[model samples]
Target: MFNNAINAYQTIQNEGLSDRETEARVLTQAARRLIICQREWAQPNLRERLGDALQYNQRIWTIFQTEMLEETNPLPLEIKRNILKLSQMVDRRTMDTLTEPEPEKLDLLIRINENVAAGLRGSVTGPVGQF
Candidate 1:
């Protein structure tokens, strides 16, 4: 468990992850873990693992929300606004899942994270609204 935490911290730390590709890679990996947790929540003795994954995902979203709100962030104004809106939705969905313990509630967040990560990697060719 400690090793997992250390690795997560390392992923979010300063090993050139500021670049778009690295950022997308980290987000995709983290999102994949969260997706797995959501899918496997019913397995034997996995409740704590689900909680840990959710918390990790929450932390990542919180960081993105905070960064997007900063005055000096370089993204276009419309993009920042939309991201901030999406972040709010993530916050709400996260709280709802925590309160209700419904794994299905995580699907939207999974799609959002995956879609954004894919967009960052330049693989998305369609409108993001469908995600």
Candidate 2:
């Protein structure tokens, strides 16, 4: 999970996005990865790892949102809304998984992440809170 986050961060940086935007994008990616892990891996240990990843992603998102909002150049509303939506999805998935997931559920989650990266990238510019 850490490796995935690192890879995502590196990818964003390689694209020349600002540090703040890169971090936000990476966290979003990490959250998406966790969603994938939760759906694909059946092992209890793997599920626990996914939980950890979710927690970490939530922390990153919270920090990013707060910092971005405080910046003189605030993030656009569309990006902020997307971030909130992603966060809510994580929360919902985690809550649902506390029990047991239905069949084909993982596939749905995989699809969610598959499209989220592009949407996240398209939502904002000039870093996460720099309008």
Candidate 3:
């Protein structure tokens, strides 16, 4: 699934998607990796796999932070602030999970990734305030 997701992202990229679509694919890929790690937590290779997944997710959020912080970014100030706040939450949760290594700790990261990806794709179903 991980390889398939990467292939899908690459194919989407080659097909000339908008930036939001590319970002959505990236977030979905990250979320899928974390979901895999979470589901396989009891496997013998969990430590290494979890570390890689967490690092991958962290890198994705870090890229988002860098983009949002750029002075030329076009997002409204309120929206940028909200995204940064969410990224901060991701950062803290990531650090906590790295320190304590709990299976349940991955839920928030997964949810954030899924929600943000959905939002990027304009498929969010709930009220706007929920996001």
lDDT of each: 0.72, 0.56, 0.82
Cα error, residue 28 of model 2, in Å, equals 6.6
Weakest ten-residue segment in model 1 by summed lDDT: 122-131
lDDT of 2 by residue, 55-108 (tens): 555455455455546646467877767766765675576556645745344443
**Which runs in model 2 stand beyond 4 Å of their true positions?**
1-17, 28-32, 35-40, 71-73, 99-116, 120-131
* Regions of model 3 farther than 4 Å from truth: 1-12, 125-131
**Model 2 TM-score, all chains together:** 0.49
**RMSD after CA superposition, every candidate:** 4.6, 7.7, 5.1
lDDT: worst 10-residue window of model 2: 122-131
TM-scores for all candidates: the values are 0.78, 0.49, 0.84
Error of 3 at 50 (Å): 0.6
Q: If the candidates were sorted by their TM-score against the true structure, best first, what order would they fall in?
A: 3, 1, 2
Q: What is the per-residue lDDT of model 1 for residues 1-131, given as tens digits with 9 covering 90 to 100?
A: 43554466566656766457765665676677777776687888566776776677677667778889899999999998888898889888878877787778878877887788887777974423233
Instruction: Give the C-alpha lDDT of model 2.
Output: 0.56
Best-fitting candidate, scored by TM-score: 3
Q: What is the lDDT of residue 21 in candidate 1?
A: 70
Candidate 3 residue-wise lDDT, 8-94, digit = tens: 557878889987898787887778778888778889999888888888778777778888999999999999999999999999999
